[model samples]
Target chain A: MNWIVNNGDLIGQLVVAHLATAIPPIILSFFLSIPIGWFANRFQVSRGILLTVFALLYAIPSLPLFIVLPLIIGTGLRDPINVVIALTIYGIALMARSTADGLASVDPDVRQAATAVGYSARSSFWRVELPLAGPVLLAGIRVVAVSTISLTTVGAVLGIDSLGALFTDGYQRNIPSEILTGIVVTIALALAVDFLIVRIGRLLMPWSRIVGAGGGRSARRQRTAATA
Target chain B: MNFLIQAFAFIFDPKHYGTANGIEVRLGQHLLISFEVLVIAALIAIPVGYLIGHTGRGRAFAIGFSGGVRALPTLGFMILIALGVGIGLGAPIVALVVLAIPSILAGAYSGFEAVDRRTVDSARAMGMNELQIVAKVEVPLGLPLLIGGLRAASLQVIATATLADYVGGGGLGRFIFAGVQTQDYPQMLAGSILVIFLAIASEILFSIIQRLVVPAGVTAGRPKDVRVKSSRSRAALG
Candidate 1:
């Protein structure tokens, strides 16, 4: 109780820091990834190497990268730019994959038909392919957004205030309430973000409902069998 | 040749091994920790996923939650849990469990969902009990996806295990963390190289395991169904 009273301001500061660090990379990732993915889909040669690099970035440990970034750039927590850089690496990787998956899944005949109708290649991509691929692409975006939110907590370790600071403070002080608060808040934030994305996905792509609904039905059948 | 020898020497230096600190670098410890977490996560997630997926309620919720869980930066989760649970292996174990569950659950759910409805209906019409149908039909059908999920989860846990050192749990992470703290470039490089190598080795092993566990027929069987369903849904929408 005493800890919460004393540290309430700190908690607020931490939450603000987390959001600041997380949102930019997530938004930037979408911009960077979509074009790159479209290009990759159009050209087969570059896709493999680009994807491999992204995968490697994804595989690297977050802490080491966090520690290494300051060393590389000679910057400190006073600027959240370093965290943004590290988080963006993940964003690019996730979004790129999502873009590729979305574009690949589009019906080939649709592409042929658009070309037959005399649409330019670029116009066809923007007008035809991209719209059809929206749901899968957004699914990828939802993943990247949620992931970035969670990863932002690590920025707390580097002295940028955020929910992670709450965890660290609670741990250092041995205050269970503070720890619980951080955990609850972090999970709640993640859930809220995910829920919003899903809702938006449904709204933007009503056609996806049938596929989503079928996925649900089949999943239920699996559950009954597994339990039995 | 000199660089290679220097790297090897730095890697093998007894003083750098944390042995003086009573943390021996044993292959067995890594294997044990990785295997235990994988088994426990599978046990919990597979059944739960099967149930949730079978029930037809809130799949997006379950999958999204898992993705959210997976997205939680491992270091952050470890640090938080370490605070609650106190340092040592327990915190890392708990974190790994959380990390492993989502993939296993997603995999199980997707795997069973991918099973042929006609096959399931035929089994049911033939009067097989639910238990028998699941055991004989769904499990076989879902095995490949289930294995793929386990493979993914295993690789993730193994890589993330290095973060356990932050909570004072012994693993390869200790070397990596210590090298960072001390600014020992050679030590850091060596530790990272070893971690990466171990990760790759584990991934290869799991791939082989997946191949052995998931019959080739299952893989061949699924894509057609997935494509058909997706196309049908798209057509219905149009």
Candidate 2:
């Protein structure tokens, strides 16, 4: 309590830094994934290739990626941009797969119906396909948001600023409260962001609330679609 | 490209292998620690998961629990544990196992949940004991999801164990951390490449295991595409 109170301004600054590092990757990955995910979903061969590549990209550990990425992209070793770029890579890796899977979850007949109604490929994607995949995509984004917020801390060890600075500082200083503060704040931020995403999702796609609430109906519909 | 070539050279150099703190030794320690953590986590999680799946209780708790735990930052979690436990492999092991349990628990229970209720009921109607029913009916069918959980757990543990080195938990991560301190970019890149290889190998190995475990009769009539869809969806849930 004393540590937190005394260090209030420092903690505030850290939170701001954390948000700056985390949010861009979340938003960038969500938008960029749609096209990549759509491309993956559109072709049979490319789906396997793209998903595998992204999965492999994700398999690389964060610290190492932070270290090596600068060499590849010509950022300075300690540049905050390294964290942002690395996190965006991680975010896209997870979201692209989710995007592909979410898009895949949409029914084929629904696509045909949109075509019959004279919707072009581009407009149908924006209007019909993306909207229908909203729930699953929202689920994917929620995961990305939480994971990205947590991962931003990894940058602290590399000397990039974030809430994670507390962990290293606290550990070296032997102050357990500061470490606890970092952990608590990070988790709280993640859950709060997650809640906000859900709220936004509810506003954007009011229909999914009903489908999500009555999951049994959708499950049954999917079962019948499978049978048909 | 020059950096890449230097990293490969560093990896290929025979001087880095064998003996104390060699690449091979660090690699072995990394694998051993990951294996130990996975085993401990599985022992604790699988039985609880079984109970939940069998009794159809705690499903909501399990989901919420895993979700919250997943939000935890691994690096901070390790540092906190190391501070309490006073810095050793023990701290990281404890943290890693804590990190690993959620995925395995989800896997074990979800595997059982995936079994059709009608199938379990039929097995009961035919006078099979609960244990027999689980072993014969559920285990075989739920194997894929269980393995899926293990795959997720392994990937997570492997990635995280690298961070463990930050607190003096020895592994291949030593190279990356040590390289960072000395500004040795090639060495850092080399360590990253090795870890990536190990992770990808484990992924391929688990996938093969997943394919092999699918009961022949169960998957026989299903299209390959549907099989892929089911496995991927289960992954998305994780």
> In terms of TM-score, how similar is model 2 to the real structure?
0.92
- What's the i-RMS for candidate 1 in angstroms? 6.7
Q: Tell me which residue pairs clash in candidate 2.
A: none
lDDT scores of the candidates, listed in order: 0.70, 0.85
* Candidate 1, superposed: residue stretches over 4 Å from native: A43-53, A67-82, A116-118, A158-161, A191-228, B1-9, B14-28, B52-61, B64-85, B123-129, B179-189, B216-238
TM-score of each: 0.78, 0.92
What clash count goes with each model?
10, 0
Look at candidate 1 and tell me the lDDT of residue B142: 75
Candidate 1 residue pairs that clash = A14-A162, A219-B53, A219-B54, A220-B53, A220-B54, A220-B55, A220-B56, A221-B54, A223-B50, A223-B54
Candidate 2 ranges with C-alpha deviation above 4 Å: A214-216, A219-228, B220-238
RMSD in Å for all candidates: 5.6, 4.1
Task: Residues B1-238, candidate 1: write the lDDT tens digits.
Answer: 3433554577677775565432246334655677889998988998888886555466777766776675565665677678767788888888899899988897787776666666777899999998888888878777767777887787688777766766787766666557656755445545555666677777677667666766556555342212222121223334
TM-score of chain A of 1: 0.84
Fnat across every predicted model, in order? 0.21, 0.67
| Number of the predicted model whose lDDT against the real structure is largest | 2
Candidate 2 lDDT, tens digit per residue, B38-73? 999999999898898788789778878888887898
Among all windows of ten consecutive residues in candidate 1 chain B, which has the lowest summed lDDT?
B224-233
